[model samples]
Target: MFNIPASNIAHIIQLAVAPVFLLAGIGGILNVVATRLARVVDRVRSLERDLPEADPDQLEVGMRELAILDRRMGVCHWSIALSTVAALLICLVVMILFITDLVALNFAIPVSLLFIAAMVSLTLGLSLFLFEVTIATRFVRVDEQYIMRRRLL
Candidate 1:
């Protein structure tokens, strides 16, 4: 049997559960951000591929769209990086929980700090994702598309 008492181990597991859940949530966020990044990249590549055949006026529009896509891609990348860091910090917190229990040491302060840092990182990542979404909506030619559809109809 492990040197730590079963009750102590159980307590540590209980304490670790919340952080583990947080890690899973972070993972989900990362997945969404990664997918967004992939889509942005694909769009950029498609625009670039078509640029050469574009008329002068169309080329200008394509370039502007490419710039916006570039910004979105950068935002997605940062969101993913920060979320990943948060996930790693959470993993460390869980590891420390087990270590502290086994050694019977006071690690409450460090654990709390790590958890806070992870939250901060996740918040920033989520904020960036929001910003990217905003940019996507802001630059979209919704009115133009609507008019075009109406005319076709």
Candidate 2:
């Protein structure tokens, strides 16, 4: 018969908190990238609309920058998506391990499993958050501003 102490439970809770930090960090980074991309897109669109008759050389430069930004954004999105999936899988595995450990009445196993789960979950959440906050939201805002600016001009 294995009796788990309250302190152990507390420890687990603490471990669980690790994910929040990871998520926040990842979100921050993603947000920055997204914002920059959005700005670039906006600039390209603005140039296209407001300066339709501008010199071909200037137009070409804007188009090139837009293309590069688009490619980068796409790569970032896919990378984040893949990482999130992997993290989820790791979390799932940890859950399974915990369950198995519990069934066996192996305190050590469950504790280890929980620890792993917490770590994996934290990583996944952080990565997803980063991508959403840094890249995705910024991109949208930039695009919106660009469109509005072009319209007004």
Candidate 3:
């Protein structure tokens, strides 16, 4: 009810603060990973659109790059998905913190579990992001022209 004592209210707010900040950090991570996923999808779509009538050599090279892009996209998708789940779990933990204090029940175990789950999900998401980055590196086109200019000088 609305009869929460001022000190209890202050303590509850204090307990909630850390989780709220964690939620904010998770939100930022989710935003970045989601943007990366969207870019991957966009690249795949562009490649698919152009693959149909490409010249023979272009088709071969394009298909190879497309395959790599597909793998990269899969990892990106997983990263985004896991980050989303982590964000959800973090939100749940924050809610549970409030509810436990309000109802006079022990929240230690459940809140810990939820926080751990969120961390695991976030870790996996970041790992996928790392894997995708390495995959992306495989397809990056370096500026040979720039290097050649240095050689010529």
**What are the models' TM-scores?**
0.91, 0.46, 0.89
Top model number, TM-score:
1
Residues 1-153, candidate 2: write the lDDT tens digits.
268666755655555455545556545655554565466567657766855676888777766656655665565555455445445544554455445444545555555565566466546645654554464455444567788999999
Worst 10 residues of 2 by lDDT: 93-102
Question: Tens digit of lDDT per residue, candidate 3, span 1-153?
Answer: 678888987898898898788878877877787787788789879989998999999999888988888888788889888988988998898788888888889989989999999999999999998888888886777889988999999
Q: Is candidate 1 or candidate 2 better by TM-score?
A: 1
Error of 2 at 153 (Å): 35
Error of 3 at 142 (Å): 1.0
* CA lDDT scores, all candidates in order: 0.92, 0.56, 0.86
Report residue 57 deviation for candidate 3 (angstroms). 0.8
In candidate 1, stretches whose alpha carbon ends up further than 4 angstroms from where it belongs are 145-153
Clashing pairs in model 3, backbone N/Cα/C closer than 3 A = none
Residues 32-70, model 1: lDDT tens digits: 999999999999999999999999999999999999999
